[model samples]
Target: MAEVSLQNLEKVYPNGFQAIYDLNLDIANGEFLVLVGPSGCGKSTALRMVAGLETITSGTLTIAGEPMNDVEPKDRNVAMVFQNYALYPHLDVARNIGFALRLSGMPKAEIETKVGEAARILELESLLHNKPAQLSGGQRQRVAMGRAIVRDPAVFLMDEPLSNLDAKLRVQMRAEIARLHRRLAATTLYVTHDQVEAMTMGDRVAVIRDGVLQQTDEPSALYDSPDNVFVAGFIGAPAMNLRRGHLRSVDGDWTIQLGHNRLPLADSVLTERPALAGYDGAELVVGIRPEAMEDASLSDNNAPRIVVDAELTEALGSDMLVHFYLDAAAVDTGDPDVLDDLEDAALMIARVDPRSPVRSGSRIELTVDTKRFHFFDPKTNLAIRS
Candidate 1:
């Protein structure tokens, strides 16, 4: 296995459209790093650059301490699994898996041995004789993975390999891929637009936007301490609820003004975020994840709680998603890709237990985990605290 590193990587097309900008990242040997973002966010472009499928406009890419700017894709010793199962229609599963070895002129016995091992690992031993046309979508994807596995390349580049499968199969394949990574321990760079996949499959995730690198870190760290408004709003499942509010000192206590409501800031919050002092009299964006808020009836006195009017209610089996509105200005970060399908109505969703009897249009009390509240500067859109 080999480590991959990109330093100041950039990709500018002939038409003057910049696809990537000043991107720098390093994937350790045997590490699984996921590149995740919205569509047209330069994720796939960056992956292609590393795979030698696209040219690098201005940057250096190194694999195992050697520069690979002019190396051919095959000579780079990398295996790529595309979204579509690129299998030969005429070949059966066994022949398809061992096709690379066959082209390299390996003995038939060695090819069969390697193909058998790969099929056993992918649980495709029973379907080794089926053709691509006869296999299920999931089975076809496994065949594609088996083909890559038989190559035994130093690095594996997968671009949304699970997008074509159904939801249930996607989840199943997700676990299978994770298990396969553990068994092979090959350095991998996976690109996908799904945040859920990124969170679950990656040892580390890099979030990109508008052809720019926003943040790269552990999945939980990115969720708990986002570096900017874009990341804070993008990483979570229900997405973060951002509202414009003013920070002020009321009777020697720092509090945030949400329209007519004033929520006092905890002492720990002020101590951790010294930058918040500068916005004492100015507006800032306050972010809270849906899972961080709970029904007041189920909360203790030590937690920070807020009262709001519920606008809508969704009864998910395990939990309830409560939507509420406040009289704050709508949040618009100016990124059309991020804001395109967003709701015009400013709403907050609270994930509460199904046991809670809160209803729509009711004045409900919600508790905010004050320790987890995030503050972002409106001008820079970056988090006040690290």
Candidate 2:
């Protein structure tokens, strides 16, 4: 295992197209760090730069405390597992796993031993004689991993390795890979556009947008405390509900006016975010996670409530997602993936108990978890943090 460092790494194309800005990140030895963003966010470009597949226009690349800027990819001692499961169709699983050892001119018995170990680790021992065409998608993916394992690389670079599988298979492969990482304890840099995948697998996740780094933290931290409106809206499932609101002081208490309703802020909210004091009587962005609101009748929370007519309701077994229209303007997240939802600020979603009698066109009251509310500046879209 090795520590990977990228200091002010940059990538610029010949046509003057810059794909990555000054990205500074350090991956500790044996840590799993995931790079995540929407398509075309330059995440793949950044990963390619580290693998020496693309040139770094500036900055430094180091692995295990050694400069790797001018090192050849073959000499970098890093193994990559691609999304396509790049295995030779004609070769059996064992041969494909041992191919790298053969290339290095290792003894035949040693190559067989290494291949055997990799197969056992990947649970591909029974399929050693099978070709890629004969194996299932998940099995083929394991074979690809086995090939990487046999080499015992200092670092592993996986680029959406599970993306091509079916949804069920993807979920299974996700667990498999996570288990593999824990067992090997190899330093891994994984790139994916799937937020759930990143959250579930990465020890730390780095979110990027438009060639610039946005935030890097543990998955829960990124979700609970985002740095800006983009991250506030992008990190959560169903995304966060960001709407324009007026924050003002009413009788020494703070309240946010969202169109027709005013939700009082809890005292803890201000105590945690002292910076919000400066936004009193100002228009700012308010972010509410879907789970932050619940059916008032089913909730014991003493938080403020907002009444709205349910536009749609999705029964998702464990909980019901109630979609309603808030008479406020929705803030754009600056993410192309969610442009449709942000086009109108009126759309708001609340995750409520499945027993709640919320249906299309039905009136419902949602209890807002005011203390958990996220406030951001309207001008800069940055969170109001102390």
What lDDT does candidate 2 reach at residue 306? 88
Misplaced by over 4 Å in model 2 are 341-346
Model 2 lDDT per residue over 87-139, tens place: 88999999988888899999999999999999998999999999889999999
**Model 1, span 25-82: residue lDDT tens:** 9999999999998889999899999999999998999999899988998888899999
Evaluate all candidate structures by whole-model CA lDDT and list the values in order: 0.89, 0.91
Q: What is the lDDT for 218 in model 1? A: 96
Please list the Cα RMSD from the true structure of every candidate, rounded to 1 decimal place. Answer: 1.6, 1.3
TM-score of each: 0.96, 0.97
